[model samples]
Target: MEGSCKMKRRLLMFTLVICSFFIAGVVSADEDILLQQLIEETPTGGILELEDKTYTGNIAISKPITIIGKEGTSIEGGGTGNVIEIRSDGVTLDTLAISGSGMSRSSQEEHSGVRVMANDAILTNLTITNSFHGIFLNKSKNTRMSNITVVGHGANQLGTQGNGIHIMRSSENYIDNSYLEKTRDGIYVEYSHNNFIDNNTMTDTRYGLHYMYSNYNSFKENNFIKNVGGAAIMHSDHIHLEDNKFSFNQGSRSFGLLIQTSRDIHVLNNEFHLNQRGLYLEQSTSNRIEGNDFFQNEIGIELWTSSTSHVFIKNHFNKNKVHALTVGGESNNDWFENGVGNYWNMPLLDLNQDGIGDDPLEYSSSLSELVEENELAYLFLASPAITIYEKANDLLTQHKVMAFDKYPIMSERKPINVASVGVGIILAGVGVYVYRRRALR
Candidate 1:
């Protein structure tokens, strides 16, 4: 009886294992059938709508087709190549979650969530994560990438990780309304030109917008926060960076904007706040920096000796620990362009009330001359002792002027505080009620 019972138990265990394998094979068959339907069935230039289900493998769209996924539709990669690769022109991928790209940077093709080698590709409402590159436009032109959220593989080292949006040798692309974080660089433009990047939020990256040898690019209304460097416009020219917020990019060698070895750049109407350096210019010339507001920065502007022929006008420098720092030479740059100078938050001598100061506003101090030579001076920027020492030295010695505004602005052209006005109105109403009560009594 004991031998018979042991034999029955072995047969039962064998049957359970066979049942589990059969179920797994059925599921695998279903996944393979769906993948075959996607690859071998879709016609060229057709609109294929995926259901709200998960599909797997590396899809290569080699024809002009449009793939629109339903809500909650996801395409997981096979962990070998790019999740999706568009090879033909006029392809579109919308509303899909693409992830699990291969980690092989040594491959000829970059491993990415989506790789577009075709022109006029449109990618919208994509959630790309856990990929080497979120979206890589490789020599693709006239592409429109909008409303996408790209998160990188944050666990990888900086040298091995890729950028959120990497535009390489591409032109005339429109990238808008994207959120990029934890990437090596938020949006990297390398040898790309005539690109319009607007309404994007980039944070927790090396640089928000890393421009390298790119020209005729415009970045407008973007928010670059909590990054190592906000935007590094290096070895490039003809860039228009306007209406962006560069804030809280605090660290050593960090700045809201770094225009290095570039030319013909126009930086206008941007807000640079709470940065280690609001703007850092090095070896750049023939740039127009105008109508910008720099507030609460460690140093508002750090103009290197090699940076020349820059015109700074209508900029407001407010509450910075150091207004401007010139290293190694006199400031040959123009502080006032076309009769309007920057406002340094100082008392201006507006004798004729022409809204300009009569005397030139000088940024100078004997102690500043000494402290500017030391890199450790940044640590004591908020120290009262440093401020007192600078003022005392200025009063006792003939201070050397670092930079001067010939026509310092006198009128305040700041934004109106609606919250402050509301508080004042409430206070006045309470006071009037108290007075009426006293009179009645």
Candidate 2:
């Protein structure tokens, strides 16, 4: 009986060992299959898996493949050649860091970190740093870029010869949810069309957003803060700007938005604050401005001769140093809301108790022209000359500056408690009178 029991135990142990070996073989086979697929498909599909190691080579991708990375993967180009050039269509790049490219300095020919000459490609979640041009796309179409970070250190302030993201002669591209900092131009689109730039943050760049000879594009919900050269849109048309913020962009020739030789554009609901000039329109016409906020700027809007036939409606202009509108030539056919006026922070005397001032707000031509020439005219804002001008306007209009629409829609359009302004004014007046009387005594 003991021998029979020993035999059964040995048989059970042998069967268990056989089952374990079979399971191990299956797992190993699955791993080998995956690795084999990766290696086999790499040459045709051009998949170069990235790790923390440095790879120095000129790789041209001719087929569609995804080059993925384990976290902390870096591709170092060694500053002698182009890195990861795409010449094929339908490529995807994600979660990789590429650096050390950019050999050519000619504006026409330059090497970038990732150069795409293909169509229908997507680049996402890439960190491209310390390169001449971060991402350069030339003569490509139907490209999409999102969640990309392009950083150019400027290499001792010589400034990048190329742009962070350069799209030249490319069409139907979309860039969204990206952050571009410390580059020559954050994003430069030249001779492209049907592009969309939305929800991006750009800083410390020459021009945050530049569209030269590009048409029919849209910029929405982007924050361009502290950009040095500001934004320039020249020789473009059919552009639309909505819900963007341009703030603290101050310099001699800097402006929040510059439109030159552009037509049929619409700028609405944008906030421009503390900029040298909130908006500079030169030789651009047929634009509509509505529901925008311009505050604490050197000049709210500077219109050179090319700005004509523009409609300014329901825009809030407050605390700006110069005239709200500077009409240059007599042929400039611009329109403003007659009764619905902008806020200048100047007192309006409602003598008839009608809630609307009885006179037209006569903006001074000399002052406007002077401000157009010199931005420092803002320093003399509180001088007696301004007071005299206000009085003269009052006399010309019978103590009525401008009439509000009985109920004008206040833009930036907050609900105002009338009692608050009234009580504060009364208290301020009482305090001033008391102080003056005490000083006399």
Candidate 3:
């Protein structure tokens, strides 16, 4: 009986050893096929259709070639360096899953899933994960990055992780249909110009979209949600921000949009809601803000003393904690343009049949500044004493006017457009019918 048991134990140990060797062999075989080798062997302008396999190595494409891969094609770095590096223009990489890049604090270290030093390149349908930076472009122009998804490891420590898409000194690039989460800055642009960032969702980052010294860019239909800071545009100009949604960016110093030291920015048709400060402008000038909705924010617009020539037209401010406030003295910015002004939730009496209110809207209050200066004075809010005091100060003191909308529009309770309502109902009915038909089929 003892000899039989010993023989059985020996057989089990031998079988386990053979299985380990087999698994190791399979793994080695996969690692042996380096993507760099294949790229180097292929001629310039060649098209390489990668097989459905996991290539474990760093790759560098120095020539102009196109590398395409299907589903399940992965390029996993060994946690040592970038997964792919493109040095020549006209290089295209599509439909590849990349991960496991080296982490570094230095920007010169080049620790990214994909680093593009080339111009006029196209990167589409690529998914990057666990990388220090998903895509880092340095001085690369006319690059198009579309339908890219970047999932980070959620590292909040500074310099440990990088932006989902970092554009540095690049121009005329387009980033569209991308989703970025848990990165430092979802899309960071520095010294870049003439870029179009549209149809992207950036959430849970330090800043959803951060721009520093970037100009002539248009951001349309992008969603910035639940970020520490929603969108920070600093020292830039000629920016067109249209149809973007900035919401739920709540923090001590969080803002829906922070425009600092920038000029000639057009913020049109954007939604800024549920933020600590809807729009915090510091030394920003000559910007045209029109057709925006500022709702449920702590401060609708916090204008610094240096902000000037800002034209606010046809905006809707509803239920904001404070309609508008200034840091120091009152701002000298224009609130009305082209015979149109914002709709402030205030008491207005338009005796005439015209849509414009007869009286100008006082969008700021000296009483609010008093409450800020003296905290105990907040108790006087809604008290007749405060109102009397403000009136007395306005008459006797030379207090600077905060903001005046001479041509303020009527309240949102105005009659709805019948044409718009009928069109909306018809569109809703058609959408429901199509959805039901698709479900049935």
Candidate 4:
């Protein structure tokens, strides 16, 4: 009788498990179909509010509409294609957690968490992960995306991972207040122009921001840290970069900012620190690199031969191992305009108190000469022997000047941040009040 009872119990447990599996399958299928049905039933220009639950992906919006999601709403791809595809203009997607885009099934094709091919769309408050491409804008115009957080495949798989935000042939768009990490490039823009990117943070990617064949884009107030390259502006013209921070981008051939084959770029009031190279220019012309700060970099500025017609004024170079290394960069560039040149963290005689150095800054180095003559010397860079040699050469040799900066500014004037001061004073007052209360107690 005991054996019979045990067998019956085992049969009952197996049946329950089977029933649960069958019910789960049914529910998943039902939800997917119901979601599609609901979307189909919703009229154009209507709103489809999603529940705080997971929904199967491969959804497409072909009409002008808005989709609002609850706090925990998610759309997960079925590992076949993009999670969401927007095809019509005036669409809006907000407050959605999206992930699991299909892997590259072909060499020429890949999927994205959200693919926007429409114009005048607004996407906000999104959290996306495991995205092949987190968000893709293809020929989209006047689109705005803000408060987006994306995490891509690991950087170690860079060769296979797609970009965090890919904009191709898209123009006149805005991306603000976004955070992206571990993608191929944090925000890759190609043939996209008149875009505004502000107040974004990108890290652990190939580049925090990348531009190729794009023009008239503004990148401002962005934080780029721990990427291979903080930003790479290449083959673009008439771009503006201002008030950005690039830091801790340390690796081979890495730079806080790299401008290559670009022209008419305005790099102003930016900070570059703790990088392999602070600012690198290659084959670029007619750019304004002014009011910037370079600190704690291996090389503050590196100019290749073909880059010319640049203006460098009111910038500060401090605590860098080498201030500027030029390889045939006798650009006849204007280092001083309006009686003002850059401030170098070096000793200079400012006798007249006019805030100008009596002696001009002649950036010529035996180390630079050696690297130019033999590129292999760069491999031994930062070695103690190399450092010793460089110091000895600087002390002993008559170096040939590679670049010159006349009317060098001997002073650095930093603007006071009022908000920071106010915050500090409030914090101090609160601390004192707490101390007094504790003493009374």
TM-score of each: 0.83, 0.74, 0.79, 0.84
Off by over 4 Å in 4: 1-33, 105-108, 373-379, 414-441
**Distance from true position, residue 310, model 3, in Å?**
1.1
Top-down TM-score ranking: 4, 1, 3, 2
Q: On a 0 to 100 scale, what is the lDDT of residue 142 in model 4?
A: 93
lDDT for model 2: 0.74
Worst 10 residues of 4 by lDDT: 23-32
Give residue 358's error in model 4 in angstroms: 2.2
What is the C-alpha RMSD, rounded to one decimal, of candidate 3?
13.3
Q: List the residue pairs that clash in candidate 4.
A: none
Q: What are the lDDT figures for the candidates, one per model?
A: 0.85, 0.74, 0.84, 0.86
Question: Highest TM-score: which candidate?
Answer: 4
lDDT of 4 at 165: 90
lDDT of 4 by residue, 372-432 (tens): 7886665566567866886787788755565677878776974234466789999999999
- lDDT per residue for candidate 2 within 240-263, as digits (tens), equals 999999998876567899889999
- lDDT score for candidate 3 against the true structure: 0.84
Question: Could you arrange the candidates by lDDT from highest to lowest?
Answer: 4, 1, 3, 2
- Look at candidate 3 and tell me the lDDT of residue 83: 84
Please give the RMSD to the true structure for each candidate, in Å: 13.0, 11.7, 13.3, 13.0
Could you tell me how far off, in angstroms, the CA of residue 88 lies in candidate 3 after the best superposition?
1.0
Summing lDDT over every window of 10 consecutive residues in candidate 1, give the lowest-scoring window: 23-32
